[model samples]
Target: MLARVAAAARVRPPERTGALLSATLVLSVGKGAFLATVMVYLLQIVGLTPLLATAGLTLWGAASAAVAVPTGLLVDRGRGRAVGSVAAVCAALLVPLSARVHTPWALLLVLCVAGGFDSAGNVVRRAMLAGAGGDSVKALAWARTVTNIGFALGALCSVRLLASRSPSAYETAYLLIGGGYLVMAACFATTSLGAGRRGSPSVRAPGVVGARSLRTGGALAAATGILTVHTTLLSTVLPLWVTRHASVPVSVLGWLVMLNSLIAVGGQLAVSRRAATREGALRCFRNSAVWTAGCCLLLGLVRFAPTGWQVVLLVAATIALTGGELLEAAGEWGLSAVLAAADEHGFYQSACVLGETTQGAAGPLLVAGLVTAAPVAGWIVLVAVLGAGRYIAGFTTPPPHKAIAIDS
Candidate 1:
């Protein structure tokens, strides 16, 4: 599958292939390290109560989102290098600061800054990749695959430390994350991205990437909005819901989440292969939605579980939702690549991320409000809403306009 994708999206390496590889490595390792361990570290070691932790996560979401607007504009304006480089520095500095902090308020502030720079750097990378022609999917996949692997690897390491009955080890995770950022920063600074100007800024690829003629901005905005709602329901409300009504302990929750992450890491490459067909991709996405929504519905039926099967039911539901996550990820990256024009690629991709961040920002707050409003199955209600949103977004796509390729 990997070889096929590489072949299908043949990589005619951009000038400075070596540099881009370094950039990919640095970005993946740097961001992946802390990004993976953050949630677990906060919940397990930082001793943040769920409420404060959600707030900190919200801070990260909002800041990351706020940065996307300017970062997108900057990338479109072709000022990516500096913005990208600065992002690395901010990420590096913030990781260590985050390591030392105990106060929820302080972590909130640090996450905001960290999220902003991290997102900005990512947007710049998207723009740079869009500018590289002839192998957009492969390039994007390579980058994503690496980051996914890094996150899994980094998170495993952090988990071991946190599991060792030594709270101080949590700090070690943060420092390691900082080191990743530092390495990424250095990689970006020294690498030569221009391979004799072959894929230079002056040259434009033939696709719907840069040109705004058939603008799918409206389609993208609507689709992204719906998808964002789904994120909130799953990430914020679902966990809280399990805490409230499910037959589970805090420790059980950790393992439950682990199940999802394990599936994601193990399945991403397998799922990436399904992108070869648009309808097939959508079918997978739809199936995930159906299963996720169905699972959400099934939570209400847990009282009917067989003897000692309550945990089994919850685990099953979680796996279904994660399956949806897998499909959504595949569709998102593939469609973003297909929809973007060379010049405008960064903006569109950032738009997708922005949509996610915005929804993420709202998720915790919304979940908080709902719990306050109605303690009975509030999370379940929210999950249903998200499932609805996902279903709506999937079906409401505007009719395709003559099968336009991203880079014509």
Candidate 2:
């Protein structure tokens, strides 16, 4: 089965590839702009209290999570391109409205609906890539790299807006972001990528097959979810830990994040290539566990280090964490591709997204709370959990030859 799929896989034509990647870049730029400015806009311009802002964002996340599977189901039924384009357009229309919202209820409603559409757009994009049939992991890696570049550019643009401290500046940023989404919609609408297995006999009665695929994909997701904790640690816990405990200057945090992004942009493609096969993906997963564990240990010791060494250790730890991040991403993509039934890419992809969404939603508070309370012990607990997850992944992932047989 693996060989057969490989044989069937063909490189996308240059025009299609260009269109898809261009859309990804545009979407990511909008995402980056939104992330860089949304909180400040909500708090300063919109006059929401911190607690209300948090609650509204939480509701947005919930809406995204709630709609993921249903959007995926729609994609599986041959509507991926249509759904993606429409979702993008809807999000484009709704996001600018956020600039007009002053009340909590109005803000919450806008965010929730926009979040659902954004999440649906992402699900369709991933499903399209998965079903695209040729070196999909590498294709995704390129997309990731482009996304990072777009984000960096967008964030740079936001620095000017942030410095201006003008409400008009923020509103202008939102308008540009909405325009970006409109461009993304046009790209999706014009792309020629086929809807995989749509209307095929194999998918007609997807009930039993989808259930089985979901169970398998869900287990894969659960096993890998521990690795995703690193994301929260990178974005939220690390800066806080440094500020509160380590002697390292708070100013250094920005550089550390930049280093991670640089590494991801430079090395993600090479790492992804290594994980294009099942066995290679397993190895990547194992290596990621080791690197992440080392990172956790090094970070746990930061407070105890000499001031000069604190910076060194932090840099080293960031490098290690980035290594883990790169490998984990490649491994997950490879595993999902090999494990999913060819006709059920949307179902399996949805299961994977569900895991990521759940983790993203809950991880920050839990990780930040524990790490702040018991720094060393918290890191140790994380290492243990990650180790256990690695072991579970090894047990659950079918051997490559066996997976092929099952598919056959």
Every model's TM-score = 0.73, 0.91
Q: Which stretches of candidate 1 lie over 4 Å from their true place?
A: 1-54, 100-108, 160-173, 190-215, 228-243, 248-255, 276-288, 303-307, 367-384, 387-397, 400-408
lDDT of 1 by residue, 98-197 (tens): 8788787888899889989888877777666645665554455556656666655665555566466455665665666676666666765665441112
In model 2, pairs of residues that clash are: none
Per-residue lDDT of 1-408 in model 2, one digit per residue for the tens?
Answer: 888557535533323466778888887887887878887888888889998887767777778778877877777777788988999999998888888777789888999899888888877777777767787777767777788999988888788887877777777878889998898888778777754446645744642344446556767667666777778879888888799888777899999999999999878877988888878877787678888888889899899989999999999999999999998888877777766555566766666677676667777778888878888789988889889868866844766587567666
Model 2 sits at a Cα RMSD from the real structure of 5.1
lDDT for model 2, please: 0.78
In model 1, the worst 10-residue window by lDDT is 193-202
**lDDT at position 318, candidate 1:** 77
